[model samples]
Target: MTTLRRPEIGSTPEPLDLSFPAMPDRLGEVRRQLREWLSRCGIGADRAYDVVLAVSEACSNSVEHGYRHGGGLVRLSGVVTATQLLIKVTDHGEWKSRDEPSDPRRGRGLQLMAALVSDAVVTSDADGTEVEFRIPLDPRLSS
Candidate 1:
């Protein structure tokens, strides 16, 4: 599917579309790919790091909580526009809580995502969970 946002300069940077197995080991590779692309797109180092971290956390949640019956697909898709960096991490399995996480770590992923971005939304239903983050780019660039 085509990405919604248009980059301010030039035509637009091609969206990064990835579908990988719902496994933990793949996350590092995903972050690496995103970091390279973001840097190439003129994203500053600090913002790139925050985006990578938030995306990694979302992907980790998909593999750890979203899949249950068997292995599934985790889809990462989005593009960085002039105004914002928008990414979505979606899993094909419904979220099922396994056990309470440690006190210090609980809810930190979601919190960090929201703190880093203008908006962070996590939606879970029968199909699966989708964690979407929209981070304003220019503001971070100036800060």
Candidate 2:
């Protein structure tokens, strides 16, 4: 007899491919959709919570600082590999210097996100800002 392996129900989830118009009021909805998507990707409860928090922080910053014209858009994507979950949030507002710290209290979102996720990166260009974070479920949390 051969033992078969199949994707468990709700275990193998698809990547998230979605975009939203950049509006300060839509931030909460953006985070909600992201949270559900991450949950479906088999991410642990704790990791999913972190993803929600980090993504929300990044998006809020984009809305507040990234877009000066207030009519841009925020692009969000999630790609799950065997070992890690990758989330990319991109905005087409303006290029911010990657080295400067806006403020500890108001700008500390990125700092907290960096500490929560396995990896956090912020890239800025003439087009806009792109923030990426990877959440890894290690043996300690995957149980």
Candidate 3:
């Protein structure tokens, strides 16, 4: 597990860092922590909802696709800056490539994430896969 560092008093809060087993059951806890952290950063309800949804999609993909052979760890980290909130979901598992989803109702996680955030990027290699989201913050609320 990653140990989160405490921020200095009166300074910007530390980024949210979480490391957990990459399982479907852990998603609720991830969502809860993310919601709380974004709320503390003064993110409004609507935008926060989008942020959570987008981040969740990334985490879900990590859980579903990253570990084809066995289980691994998933790391979620978020940093809020004056202009944007940057969130990354990383998994330590072999990367799998699929041409298409076997089910017609699935495989849209990437699209949904991209639509919900200012920017979304996915990178994968032999070691693992990582998804990053950059969400613009409201200038008025970022202060």
List RMSD in Å for every model shown. Answer: 5.1, 6.4, 5.7
Best by lDDT: 3
Instruction: Give per-candidate clash totals.
Output: 0, 0, 0
Deviation of model 1 at 94, angstroms: 1.5
Best by TM-score: 3
Superposed model 3: Cα runs more than 4 Å off = 1-11, 141-143
Model 3 clash count equals 0
lDDT of 2: 0.72
Q: Which candidate, 1 or 2, would have the higher TM-score against the true structure? A: 1
Please list the residue runs of candidate 1 whose C-alpha ends up more than 4 Å from where it truly belongs after superposition: 1-8, 97-107, 139-143
Error of 2 at 110 (Å): 1.5
Off by over 4 Å in 2: 1-10, 95-105, 139-143
TM-score (C-alpha) between model 3 and the true structure = 0.86
Model 3 poorest ten-residue lDDT run: 1-10
Best to worst by lDDT, what's the order? Answer: 3, 1, 2
Give residue 99's lDDT in candidate 2 (0 to 100): 80
Better of 2 and 3 by TM-score: 3
lDDT of 3 by residue, 101-131 (tens): 4677777888898888758899988778889
Q: Residue 65 CA error for candidate 3 (Å)?
A: 0.7
**Candidate 1, run of 10 with poorest lDDT:** 1-10
Residue pairs clashing in model 1 are: none
